[model samples]
Target: MTPASLTDLKAPAKLNLFLHVTGRRADGYHLLQSVFVPIDWCDTLHLHLRTDGQITRHDLTATLPPEDLCLKAARLLQQHSGTSLGADVHIDKQVPWGAGLGGGSSDAATVLKGLNTLWGLHWPTERLAELAVQLGADVPFFIHGRPAWVEGVGEQITPIELPQALFDTPVAVLKPPVAIPTPAIFGSENLRRDEKPAIVADFLAAPKQFGCNNLEEPAKAYSQEVVQALEWMQARFGNSRMTGSGSAVFAWVDTLSHQRQPFTPADVGVSDLTQTGPWVGRMCRLIRQA
Candidate 1:
């Protein structure tokens, strides 16, 4: 057995704080505005640099593929920069797929960052962001690795420093037992594409009630039952929205928030469907150690 010379990177999950489909382009691309924040929840990646040209991956998640966008980004950078080293990658997964949390995109960005340092490419952030956009619309923001308000196919990003210390709120992420095909949600006739734009200051001022995910209607139309989860989440907390597309929903509430009344116990249990593969996950607040 040989030790894998690797660098560990945190591939964090992201939520589209709110999504608005401003317009559809001639090429069928949707213009939109939203806030994207990387939560503590994440997938883990370990990259072991190989002197030879060996781009390999050991994926532990059921939904993700070995040759996913992460590896693609690495290869793409290697080709563009002419990096001489290759690497073996391993992932210990926790983020759910098809839930619009940007788990995959984050992993891809982590790879780009890792390889840039491991191979001594020293590519600038602007160069990496450009390459990321070539990979996926959500790719560039992950490299930014900060809370941002995104627009225009998610490529346009402006990082906002969250008041993490000032407003210490608890987050609850619920992934229902379903896998949503993003294309299906986009192509579905019932998708809602209408939402008036708002000033960015409106979001920063009162993020709890600035906007909502316009992609929700179409996502529910395809899945046909997430409405219940959406309703439940909203009823439980003041701030709730469908993150990205479908299947996963999240709420923001105080950690000590009363979940049930003294006289009656409220039903807080989300539905769990026993799909062949893993389905339904509850993400607890990932505490950071000083």
Candidate 2:
């Protein structure tokens, strides 16, 4: 049975602990090896079922495009399931766009999972995850809903149990006013296409030492803002690195100090803030999935 209302469902952001571009497929997809962990920082989604069979959206924040991933996910699910039911999707977005934190993908995944419950679909996660793969590379990871070692253009997933020390580690995620394009980073000649895959045991043995992002160099080159943000985090906290393809970087901090300061363009001149600071960030804890 469908719920009367599904409101304020969270779509959490994910950090790629280490991103290694191992090889390229003939179809131009980049094969990768990375550890993806969900953080507490999240976007909020509210859903109300519609009987008219028309999916629509209401933006609590004007930041997203009209045809964003959430809308696409809803449409895809409706089409695939042949459901006459629809949804009025309302989004209160928190995750930054194009930061490589997989915000869009997470939103889509949340929609898929939430709708499965709200629409009375009763589909298993494995089946929903298969549908999620069509939306984006990172969508399936969110559907899988756990810390995992991700591979094969983000399709293959192996669940990993993190140590308690690393599981509750505090992280400072900082994003400068910039967006790093994934295509540009992958297309760059400087990108390393060959990195020996590390075993899970090695990473488990020394998670801190194993944490690194291969996309960092290209991302830094793409935006000076990314460089400054990374440097700032590095100076404040040790073991700093870019998360995904770029624009946002994070560092493992022993203690988290939550302070919201307005970010000015004079900081980098790349900010897109109309009101809120163009530079957005958060201090989050990695909560291990049961």
Candidate 3:
């Protein structure tokens, strides 16, 4: 008989308010500075703990590979903690893959956090975050569980609190029927590897225009879909920018009302999400940091 019941958890998506590649490490990893915020678009995770020491996945989408990040997270935690327990992971993926929305990294972070409790490890989040970085550049941010100022190849995180009005600022997110390969974007000859580092105070002073994404030119060169998405948002929402590397763009909505839910289509100038054919449109808000 199974000793534990199944648990359902959320793995939320994130948006990069601004991403700047300041330089490259001697080892070739790009150094970055950015503000990362969590959005309402999330993937659901169902986990069942097992004493049998066999990690498995019941994938709802065939698009995910057998060696996806979430499974890797579970195994990594199991090995480190020296826990004899394993997990059966079921994923209901909603965040579009390869869109620079940090879906896979978030999934991995959720798995690591979840397993710590389910396995009775009670490890501190700081320790978990240290482990998470090995999974991906974005994984530690999710484990930090806050909107953050990220630097140092995404290993350094500083949590920042935003005014509630910023949270009230509505956002519209759109993904074209395409994906951007992060490695290709990073490796492009056109990529900018030298931008002056930004100060948090300066960013807070003019939240919208602190740093430009160094990856946009290279990303747009490869994906016309990214160009189309940005153009569409700029036409409607007045100002638009690609979230991370490319393929998904977000625009600020001028209209603001108190919204009980994270997503409200009316807040984003969209009357309905279902009508946005071939484009995945979602209304989202910046979650309060942490």
Off by over 4 Å in 1: 1-4, 60-62, 164-167, 258-267, 271-279, 283-290
- Tens digits of per-residue lDDT, candidate 2, 1-290, equal 56867998989999988888888899999889999999988989999988889888888356667888889999999999999999888878888888999998998999999889888999999999999989989999999879999999999999998888876667778877678789999988768888787789988887866847888888877877778787777666655789899878887766544223322333323344424447876777786751
Give the backbone clash total of model 1: 0
lDDT of 1 at 240: 62
- Give all candidates' CA lDDT scores: 0.74, 0.82, 0.82
**Which residue pairs clash within candidate 3?**
none
Better of 1 and 3 by lDDT: 3
Mind giving the per-residue lDDT tens digits that candidate 3 earns over 77-97?
999999999988888888988
Error of 3 at 8 (Å): 3.2
